[model samples]
Target: MAAEVKLAVRGAGKRYGEMDALKDCSLDVAPNSIVSIVGPSGCGKTTLLWSMSGLHGLTSGEVLLDGRRITGPHPDIGLVFQEANLLPWRNLMDNILFPFEVKHQKPDHGWIAHLLERVGLTGFEKNFPNELSGGMQQRASIVRALSLRPSVLLMDEPFGALDAFTREEMNQLVEEIWMETHTTIVFITHSIEEALFLSDKVVVLTPRPGRVLNTYEVPFERPRTMEIMAGKEVYDLTYRIKADIYGQSRMQARAAE
Candidate 1:
């Protein structure tokens, strides 16, 4: 039997004035699974991510967690965006513990320290955001989001600002975090290969007024390695995903003409 859906987007749609950003985009995320969203530029991937996080409301549908409708931000969800967005003055440990202070909860030093080490930020606790490298700052941002131990994490191209080598390292770190915490993640990115590398399922969306074009269940078993990305199957799936996106783009253009 299929696993229980930890997060569900039911016929979700969003309209910005006359612009329809998304339409009937529904998806299910299984517990402990990594699901990646990919599509052409401006296909509303980030909008959908926000909708799931309950930060943005849908015009037509609803998002649910454990079958409960999300009308606004829930304690069980956390967000990480492209930039580290850390406060320059806070220092690593303080930044990671900021979430606890927001909710008026006491900080969990043990968990924070463990997450810091997992993301390779252990010794940098005393360092300010500027003291860290780009990748290190991003890692600190991730640890901050995960600090609350939310059941679901929404990542909007969290590593898009990093260099290629650092991006790959961060991707591996994302997988490791999911494997360790079993936190269901909905990652948004434009890179097909990166999506395939890190997701249990890679979901492709159509151009403007984004809708689900296709979903590919990655056949590779975990713990996944970069070597899987070099295989023929990866190339084949990549080709198919591109074809789906490009083919839809062409059809949309013709309709406009």
Candidate 2:
């Protein structure tokens, strides 16, 4: 829908021995847009995200970024997982800057400071992961992934581990980051509310051996507030998307498992 595709998944699929994880999956991501993928349990959501990262190979298709094929991990892409995965021994700032050390590259301290400020992690730089709360740790993880200023960020349920309040706060933080940086993102989540609240478009995947089912555009305007979720439109769309996911013999449960 948005002009000029930044990332494309073409007839993609992945099979492991006798188990098929994804099949004929295809989608396009326009630059700076947030696309959320949701589906039932074991629907290959993680598999698909991994394939896009080029960290895992697809059995049947390809992923292209900026018209170039992604055969392996690309520097322009970054990932954040459900857990912060921070090192216990390192201070927060060192952990955030770990990627730079791995690449033997000099980090732009200004960029680090800006990202830390954006994520509300500025003064906590000296704290270790053990000293920070879960939300703070996750924020550190986000900043770490973003330290290199990747063009596209692939997030696999990055906020799934937090409490409802903390998750909402992270969602707000994500929206702010996206607006400020205009970084393209493909987020995988099981929460339809979370997906609708944060994405420009919500992508639905079928049950196991997952494939693209449908994509719904979020008609809400930008700079959305939490109040949008309590409104009738989101309420209506939520059920509609649920019907789409449920129609396939799978229903959402809340943690939804």
Candidate 3:
């Protein structure tokens, strides 16, 4: 059976003064499914994500979470950005607990311990952000976002700053966590490989005034490994997505001219 839809974007449009960033884009994300949005730079990928998260309002249409329109950010959603954004002054445990601390809620020590172990940061709780590697910092940020037990997680190029190897490691860790927690996720990334590796559905968008170009359903099974990326199917899909992105850029350029 298909998964239940947990989030929906209906005929969404976004504009910044005279410039249109997104137009008539619609998508449905399933509960516990990982959906990744990818496109050429400046294609409104981030705009669409923010609109869905209710951090930015759409010019038209609506963003729905569990059938209710999202007018603003809610506690049910968690967001992670390109930068880890951990407070350098706070140690790892305190960083992960920051959200609870700010909300004045009692930290669930057991759950926090499990999260630290799940991300392989158990012993580094007292260590500062600078003491950890880039990947480690990102891990802390992710756990911190999950600290609230949000049903939906929005990640915008969270691992984009890490080296390729570190990025792959982080991807594996994310997949592992997703398998365990099954949180609905909307991830935005520029890398086709990363999108394919992490997403159940990869949504491609057109350049500025972005619209949905295509949504590819990944066929690979869960607990995926690096070897799957080298397979013929993955290679073909990667090539096709790259070609489509380039093709869209060419078409946009010609239209501008």
Each prediction's whole-model lDDT (CA): 0.91, 0.91, 0.92
Which is better, 1 or 3, measured by lDDT?
3
Q: Give residue 32's lDDT in candidate 3 (0 to 100).
A: 93
Compute each candidate's TM-score over C-alphas: 0.96, 0.94, 0.95
After superposing candidate 3, which stretches have Cα over 4 Å from the reference? 1-3
Across 186-217, the per-residue lDDT of candidate 2 in tens digits comes to 99998998999899999999988899999998
Name the TM-score of candidate 3.
0.95
- The regions of model 2 sitting more than 4 angstroms off are 1-3, 250-257
Clashes (backbone N, CA, C under 3 Å), per candidate, total 0, 1, 0
For model 3 the local lDDT of residue 20 reads 92
Q: What is the TM-score ranking, best to worst?
A: 1, 3, 2
Write one digit per residue (lDDT tens) for candidate 1, span 1-257: 97699999999999999999999999999888899999999999999999999997999999999999999999999999779999887988888888887889998889988999899888999999998899999999999999888999999998888899999899889988988998999999988988999898999998889899899998798777767888899999999999998998898899999
Residues 71-154, candidate 3: write the lDDT tens digits.
998889999988899999999988888888888999888988899899889999999999999999999999999888999999
Give the clashing pairs for model 2: 253-256
**TM-score of candidate 1 versus the correct structure, residues matched by position:** 0.96
Candidate 1 clashes between residue pairs 3 or more apart in a chain or in different chains: none
